[model samples]
Target: MTTLVKLDHVTRRFGDITALDDVSLEIDSGRIVGLLGPNGAGKTTLLSLVQGLRRASSGTVELFGGSPADARTRRHLGCTPQETALPPTLRVGEVIDFVGAHFDNAVPREELAAEFGISELLKRQTGALSGGQKRRLSVALAFVGRPRLVLLDEPTTGLDVDGRRALWAAVHRQQDAGATVVVTSHYLEEIEALAERVIVIGQGRVLVDDDLSAVLDQVGLRLLRLTTPTPDRVRALTGVVDSRPEHDGSFTFFVQDADVAVAELVRSGIQFSGLTVRGATLEEAFLTLIADSPKQNDAAGVSPRGI
Candidate 1:
C-alpha cells in the first residue's frame, strides 16, 4: 500500500511545553487507523499537523507524497473536529451546502443528508438541533467532499448506542469507497470495531503501533476466576500473579497461563463450583500500558492548543 500521510521527526513546542517530541509516523492508503491516548497525549496535535492547520515547529509533515500545505494534497483530505464549528443561526442543510461549495466534486446534498437521517433536519437551525442530531450533521458535513483521507476527532461523542451503530455503518460505507480514515477516540470498544491498526501515544510520543490483535496479544494479561470455598488456598498457587477474593467464596487470579494454572488447581483437589478464564480487552491493555510507563506523570501537565 502507498503511504498516504507521513510525519518525520516532528516537533511542536510552546514555551516550556513540548506538545509533540520527535514523533514519526506513517499512515497507508485504504486503512482505518485508531489514534489513541489519554488526555494531553498529542493525538489532536498530530491530526492538526496532518490537516496543515498548524505547522510543525521543526521537521516535516507530508500528505499524499507532498507537503501538507499543497492545495492538491489538501483537496484529498477532510477533518471533523471534536467540537462542532457550524454557525448557530444557519440551518443544518445550509452548513453542509456552504462547505460542499468548496469541493470540486461533492456528494449530492439530498443523498448526503438522507444517509445521516438528517433530511428532515435540513430546515432546522444548528442551535435548535439536539446533541446527537448536531453530531450527525457535523459528521455528514465532514464527508461532503468525499475525500480520500478523513480525520475524525471523537466522532461519536454525543451519540447513543443506536446512533453510534448508524455512524459506524456510514464509516464502513466510506471505507468501501476506498477512503483512509484516522480517528481519535477514547472509546476503546468502538476503536476495536472500526480500526484494523491501533497507535498508542504517551508523553507526546508514539508508544505502540501495530495490528490491533497483535498489540492486544503483547499487552493483554489473562485473569482466571475460580469459585472455591477456600480462597486463601487458591491464592497460594505457584503461577498466581495476583489474587483477590470475592464476597461469594470465589477468587479472581491474574495469571500468565490459564491452562497451566487450572491444571495445578485441579491437581491440588481444590473444591470449586466453576472457573472462568478472561482475556484482557483493548481498554484494559491501554490502561495497563499507560499505568506502567513513567512518562504518564509527564503527560498530565501538557496540553496542545487549537486542537
Candidate 2:
C-alpha cells in the first residue's frame, strides 16, 4: 500500500510546553487508524500538524510524499475538527456544494448527504440544526471533496447510539470506497469498532502501536472472578498477575491464562465458588499500557488526574 502520511522524528512545542515529542510514524493508504489518548496527550497537536494547522517545531511531516503544509497536500486532505464552525446562514446542501466546488472530483452533494444520514437536513440552515445534526454534517463535509485521507476528530461527539452507529456505517463506506481515515475519540468502543490499527498515545508519545488484537494480546490480561476466603493465596499462585478482593467475598485475579489459573485453583483445593473467567477489554489493555509507562508519565508531568 502507498504511504499517505509520514512523520520523521517530529516534535511540536508551544513556547514552554512540548506537545509532541520525538515521534515517528507512518499512515499507509486504506488503513482505518484510531488515535487513542486521554486529555493533553498531544492527539490534537499531532492531527493539527498533519492538517497543516501548525508546523512541527522540529523534524518532518509529509503528506502524499510532500510537506503537509503545501497546497497540493491540503487539497487531498480533509479534516473534521472537534469543534466545527459552519456558516450559520448556509443551508446544508449549499455548504456541501460550496465545499465540493473546491475539488475537481467531488462526491455529489445529495450522495454525500444521504450516505451520512443527513439527506433530510439538506434544506435546513446550519444555525437551526441541533448539535447532533451539525456534527453529522461536519463529518459528511470531509468527504465532499472526495478526499483520499480524512481526519475525523471526535466525529460522534454529540451523537446518540443510533446516530453514532449511522456515522460508523458512513465511515465504513468511506473506507470501503478507498479513503484512509484517522479517528481520535474519548470513546473506547468507537475506536474498537472502527479502527483496524490502534495507536495509544500518552504523555506526548506513542505508547503502543499495533493491530487492535495485538494490543490486547500484548497486555495478555485475563480476569478470573470467584468467591474465595483467602485472596492472598490466589495472588501468590504462579501465573496470577494480581488479585484484588471485592466487597462481596470475591476475588478478581488478573492472569495470563484463565484455564491454567483455574486448574491451579482446583489443584490447590482452595474452596472457591462462583468462578467466572473472562478476557480483558480494550480498556483493561489500555490501563496496563499506561501502568507500564511510569517513566514516560513522569517526564511528561502526567498525573493520574490528567488521564
Q: Pick the candidate with the highest lDDT.
A: 2
**Where is the poorest 10-residue window by lDDT in model 2?**
298-307
User: Which residue segments of model 1 deviate by more than 4 Å?
Assistant: 224-255, 258-277, 295-307
lDDT string, candidate 1, 229-297, tens digits? 787777788767555555666766766688888888889998987789998556545654665565553
Listed in order, each prediction's TM-score against the native is 0.81, 0.83
What is the per-residue lDDT of model 2 for residues 1-307, given as tens digits with 9 covering 90 to 100? 9999999999999999988999999999877999988778899999999988899999999998998777777788888834359889999999889888888899898889888888999999999999899999999989888889999998898789999998999999999988999999878889989999999987788989999888867876898989887878887898986555566778777788888888998898888899998886676556555655665434322223221
Each prediction's whole-model lDDT (CA): 0.81, 0.84
User: After aligning candidate 2 to the native by TM-score, how far in Å is the CA of 194 from where it should be?
Assistant: 1.7
**Largest TM-score belongs to which candidate?**
2
